[model samples]
Target: NALTPPNFIKSIIEEDLRSGKVKEVVTRFPPEPNGYMHIGHVRAIFIDFALADEFGGRTNLRFDDTNPAKEDVEYVNSIKEDIKWLGFQWDNQYYASDYFDEMYNRAVLLINKGLAYVDDQSADEIRENRGTLTEPGKNSPYRDRSVEENLDLFTRMKNGEFKNGERVLRAKIDMASPNINLRDPVIYRISHTTHHNTGDKWCIYPMYTFAHPLEDAIEGVTHSLCSLEFEDQRPFYDWVVRECEMEAQPRQYEFGRLNVSTMVTSKRKLRKLVEENLVDGWDDPRMPTVSGMRRRGYTPEAIKSFIYETGISRSQGLIDIQTLEHFVREDLKLKAPRTMAVLRPLKVVITNYPEGESELLPAENNTENEEMGIRQIPFSREIYIEQDDFMEEPPSKYFRLFPGNEVRLKHAYFIKCHDFIKDENGEVVEIHCTYDPATKSGSDFNARKVKGTIHWVDASSAVPAEFRLYEPLLGEDEESEELAADETNDVSADEVDDFLKKVNKDSMEVVQGFVEPQLKDAQPQDKFQFFRHGYFNVDPKLSEPGKPVFGRIVSMKSSFKL
Candidate 1:
């Protein structure tokens, strides 16, 4: 982490520590447990944990579960798992709901100070009156209610005396302020729903803007780091902390968020994909979610390295997804074992070889990693090669397989295609080739040279597998389409339909393939580099005994340079 380049946030923290403005650097990763964490959250997680750890401070994992209508325990558990998976352990775990009683008291204190009031305006009515950027908002009719009356009404609201959204508590801020967020923003709303953590303990819920600062102050958080979108909300954030008169005042800082090309990081869009059965689930490999990337075989080291390389900045830029993929390849190059997996299998028969015999051939597990040593691969009379490797009618410079052409079978022998059998539909059903004993692999046979070499798996002992190849979920043209900038934004039905239309139909392709018998026992999450097929991870959810499913993490090659 010391190698990480110093950015503005780091400089600020250093100044704060040096000037004694802060006794310690305490940060918190407060995510609402309404959905799964995605790659976009990686930068915040890194900054929070790394900066706090570097300063010998602590970081807390806090769930901002203010909106119980969308929050659930299932999402909370998934978030915790994701943080741990990213190689971070929180100093303490807390939830906003834990301080509901204290938060209520703080709201009451605001009411007593004449800084807040209860509003009877409906949500739509409030929105309609809350003016646009060019105009000032009109004050609510109930904004002038006396402190005692507001307190009584707020208490009744908490007692579930009103239906959902019938009333809300608003701060006594300027309605004519240029900043829309300062226009007497709703601080609390009546929601008669059970919270994931608090259950049916209360019907009134504090809004996120109000509960966030309170939670930070209650936890003694020194710095509350959030994305640039919250930069405008900082005024209100400070207002809540100052007006509520919290014992501990936590300052808010904003940094640009990480955005990837062609990735939909919005939780609403992601949820729609899952809810509508457009994707396999939240952990679908094509998704940009942390759990999805994990299932896709991305290593924690790769993700961390990518975030570090991106660094901290104030400009929100779209990073090429290939840049992230480059890190995955770098991390996996030496770690994953090299093996052969024949996707789209083409049966090849070594007609001249001993019909019923097979032999073990020596193959290095990883060419670049000597410590991996060697592995024995079975070679028999019949084997499976990739279908695209061969061509009955060849093209120029094609160096894989063709009729009457000799090509070295990787880790095996020199085999020359002689004949091919065709089905009634004129499809090539099988290929017949003959192997020369004198040209065995690792031998000093220089008498004949083959212009091509291809990889294969012994059909007799191969493990049948399902291969899932993936592409970007959204098409290139759709990449620039604007989505909800914030995760909490509500997406309309038309928006969902328009987004779905842009989804690439060919995002994933499934094919039955065969891998070397050595991978027969490959467990879920086990990673490997298939010869000519890039890297793959065993599908955790779909893979079963004897028929393992492999998801292609990335291809064998990329034009992307770091």
Candidate 2:
């Protein structure tokens, strides 16, 4: 697993390198500046940067900003931050709109060469004329227009003479081509909206299919790598480069995209989650955005290692979300400090021990990492253990604290339960126990051992905190579904409703808890592994001075093996 396995695209790059087909490799991550980047983008990001780096090459961070209606500066900044947080740096940053003048001139060149023509057909009319996969499409009525007239009209259209949907520029490719993408796909459409970068300098914008190929060519990108979903668009990509006659030709190769089993990667569906208030924002901890994972306590090293383990393959299948959690736990085992946190507090009074007194008990920071050293935790006569740790009438074989059973307090002393109190609702509220000072942990004395050890915090010194436990964000994982509605270039209202229905309403549960006093100065993003709980990150957004909100990254135990 040390060396990356061979895949189709990697083979192609290796072959290209061996035959001197390329000297230096140049790749680009051209993300559309429309929405926040998600985990799926991490795969493409890894592929683009890793492939180029393998060959001593460079990768460019380019924003395909052709559609101005949905793009904004916020998405652009988030994308950069996500990439940086992912630990990959781009050699250069460029926007698709940066080459608007050249794109417009290229449109004019296509017109002059009779390879393009401006059509007056409405969008619905064009769709109606564009035949299905089994049927041949008919040419536009404006297909036979003279080159001079088409050029004049295209210039006027660019000059804002025509309203949106009134006209569009189409490729002069074969209308009867078996590949429907080659059936005179519209290359440019009129949009009156101002671009985030270009402002009102241009109203006629090039389509993604048209602008993508040209952008790569202009940047001298040698290899354009992307997901297999774009395989069909490769032909149109080649067409624009060949017909437009660019100096540099970036060959496109497709690989299977990374799809986690229990999450949605569709941008539109994710946008729906944000707009419908089902999620806090694009970076909501439940959402699968890179920022979401970061905020949820996922480390860059862990994420990168997880991707490396997933490998670069052409036949990616449904990756279990547990696999990701596995890597997260593995990375934190030695790195994150081992600490005790009582999530749901159950007051325990040491009736026979010294009352109104607390003692400092030595606790190891991490058993696996001794170099992290040790810290002393304050243990009081009236300490707080997890509410679930004590069952007044536990079932068979339950060795935890019961009416008469004894359990060891982790890193402290063995405590025997004597009595319990209940509220009017018949719910157990308080417990009475007696701690044997001779049985204190790390003591040179040995006594009778207990099968159960539960974590607890000092009542007087424990810092109050909030614990946020998260589950699968969606109730229905994308089982065999191949593509999101957006991939088909359409998302229906019914589909949105159905996706919304699958959202897990119980995705998050917040409860007040107590942590060791050492966490009093724990700043945002501090990570810790709680005994019997899970790895947690200090919530950067909701954490306040002396009171932190911890987001559970993953539990300590897992059924996943590799």
Candidate 3:
């Protein structure tokens, strides 16, 4: 963590503190509780918590629940869990709805100052009038309404007298401004839906843009850090705090949003994937959600380390997802116990070894971590090796278990394949081999050298398990096309359909396997390095007593380096 590169945001915070421009570096992670937090949110969460903590300041966990129709308590709870799991705790917790009354009062103040007006334009009409970047916007006919009439209309709208979108309160800003966001944006809209927090107490809700700045000011947040997409709205943010006469002004700062290649962080797309049964749920191991990564055995240390290394900047760069996997591997290598798990198991009968006889072999839990000590693995006459480990006709350089070729069985004896059994379909079902007793592991039997080492589990003691291997849900090329088509994040139904079509059907593959008996009691979330296979974590949601399910966290090798 100390080696993480310093970011411009940190420099700005230091200068602010040094100049007495900021008394304390109070920040907030305000997430709308509409969906689970994804990997993309990790950047914001880290910046908010880390920067504040670095300055001996505090951060607040605020739920931007202004959009009651889309928000839910489930998302709120999940967000909190994710933040805690990442090892950062908020100094205070707040919700945007908690200050709805205050926000309404502020709107009233704006109306009183003749800085806001009631707009009766239809949503379509409003959009049409809000001209493009090349043109200036046209003022609403209702924009110049008298202060008294505007106040009465806004009050009536809040009283549930107006249907949803029938009326809205608009800030009376410039219509001819080059920045279209300053063109009298809608500040409030009538929504009759019940709020998760407020219930039926209120019928109208403040727009997110209008409510966010007020929430920051009310909470005394000194720095309102957000993604680059919100940079265009910073002017409105400042306008709200200043015109509303908020005693505590929170300045807004923008940082580049983290984007990972081949990752879909759009909440709508994620929700569609779950609803359409394209994925198991939000916590599917293949998902990019924090819960998903956690369930897949990604460590908090790895995620935090990834965030630090990625750093913060004004340039939005597409990061290779492998960089993240690199961190996970780095964090897990020494911690996870090493064990053998034969996926696609092929029964191997050591004909020369005595039948019904088994012995315990000592194997280091982790070669690099002697502190983990050693674990006893079962070795027997009959054992299961990876099907791919043996070949009747092997190519050159294939040093594993070809006929007459000897290979060391990890933690056991060197075994030489002599013959194999084939099913009626001519598929190799089993292999016949002979183990050299003199070549037992830990013995001083280096009479000859073997070119290959393979891993296996004792057939008698191997635990039946399920291994869930994963690939990226979206291919890199498809993801690039999707991003190019949908830059606004406002996905349409057709776009969703097209995106779903691009979902990799083979993203996940479940195969029955055998793990060493030492893993028979492996609890959910327990992590281990499968010998010559990959790193895996016990599936928290599916693993049951005596029937463990392991999700491959990452492969054993990666071309990427940190």
Question: Which stretches in model 2 have alpha-carbon errors above 4 Å?
Answer: 1-5, 444-447, 479-481, 484-490, 558-562
- Each candidate: RMSD: 2.5, 2.4, 2.6
Output the lDDT of residue 277, model 3: 89
What are the per-residue Cα lDDT tens digits for candidate 2 across 63-171?
Answer: 9888888887889999999999988889999999999999988888898899999899888988888898889988899998999999889989989999998999999
All candidates' lDDT scores? 0.89, 0.87, 0.89
Q: For model 1, give the RMSD to the true fold.
A: 2.5
Q: Give the TM-score of candidate 2.
A: 0.96
Model 3 TM-score, all chains together:
0.96
Model 1, span 12-60: residue lDDT tens? 8899999999999999999888889988888889889888888888999
- lDDT tens per residue, model 3, 313-368: 87777888889999999999999999899998999999998888888999999999
Superposed by TM-score, candidate 1 places the C-alpha of residue 90 at a distance from the truth, in angstroms, of 0.6
Instruction: For candidate 3, give the lDDT.
Output: 0.89
In model 2, what is the error at residue 288, expressed in angstroms? 0.5
